[model samples]
Target: MKILIGNRNYSSWSLRPWLVLRHFEIPFEDEVLMLSGSGWREALQRRSPTGKVPVLIDGELAVAETIAIIEYLAEKFPDRAIWPRDQGDRALARSAAAEMHAGFSTLRSRAPMNLRASHPGKVDLDAVAGDLHRVETLWGSLLEKSGGPYLFGAFSAADAMFAPVATRLRTYELPVSDRVAGYVEAIYALPAFQDWLAKALQEPWVVDDDEIDVIQGRVAPGTLA
Candidate 1:
């Protein structure tokens, strides 16, 4: 198996399936293409037919989109337990993952992932308040229901799907309930995520366009941890 991904620092979509493969200790080769300069588009085309990063190439199967890649993994490796075992739990998990994939555009656009940078203050929440509230409610309910250190009692696709949101929370210092904040912290503590963060910190490349979200226009406050 092989996955094509973008730079670790700014590509939230790339992080999703990459984290899953790492978390599960799945044997896969990964290639990282920097999402900078004028050649990125041509580079992506050469990697995946969809012309996107995070495309999993397994034998003849090529999966695009984070959710699709994960689902493909689930079917191919049924014993790995990629989704919850219980029917009801599995359905709920899928719903949450789908919501994360299709919605949350406001938060996504306003706060791009910058793993090497930290912003400790809120710029403002009004712009993203509705999405923020829904996330809090969804996370709070899931945590309470599953007694979670993860969203569905164990680390599954749902957690992977929302992993980027945790990064967004830290990047923007966006307000969230203590429970949700703890969820973010828990995801951060995962060995897979930590490994990704270490590499991101070491990366010399940077995309100037991605840093525009830093409201104060200040330097990196500290390591994203």
Candidate 2:
């Protein structure tokens, strides 16, 4: 099995499957495709039918989309326990991941994933604020129901689904209360998250389009530096 991913720093979609595989201890070869300039576009077109990162290729089968890839992995490695065991918890987890997959366009657009960059207390968009509020509510409710640490107690597909959002909230310093802060801390403390960030910090490829300048705790209109 082989997994094709994008840049470690900016490709949130790529992080999903990568984290899932790592969390479950699934042995797979990783192929990192740096998404800089037209190279990413051409590479993705050739590598995946959907031209997206996080494609899982198992011999002849090529899987695209983060959720699909995760579901496939869960089925393929049932012993790894990727999803919740309880039926009710599994339903909620799937719903949470699906909601994350479908919604949060505003937040995603304004704060694209750049795991290595930290912009302290710099939230300025109302749409993004609303999305963050929803996320906090979701996280708090899940923590309350599951009892500490991950959203579903043990790491599930849900955690892999929301890991990028956690990184976004932390990097941008978005408004989060104690509960949300604790949850984010747990996510950052995960071994997989630590591994991914360490690899990302070592990479030298930087995209100018992804970087933003800040003034007085707000992103200023400037090209990537």
Candidate that would win on lDDT? 1
Off by over 4 Å in 2: 214-225
Q: What is the lDDT of candidate 2?
A: 0.86
Model 2 per-residue lDDT tens digits across residues 85-197: 99999999999999999998887877778877997655566768789889988989999999979999998889999998988888898888899888889989999989999
Cα deviation of 89 in candidate 2 (Å)? 0.4
Q: Candidate 1: deviation at residue 45, Å? A: 1.5
Tell me how far the alpha carbon of residue 110 in candidate 2 is from the true structure, in angstroms, after superposition: 1.0
Off by over 4 Å in 1: 213-225
Worst lDDT run of 10 residues, candidate 2, spans 214-223
**What would the TM-score be for candidate 1 when compared with the true structure?**
0.92
Residue-wise lDDT of candidate 1 within 62-144, one digit each (tens)? 88989889998988888888899999999999999999999999888777788888866544578889899999999999999
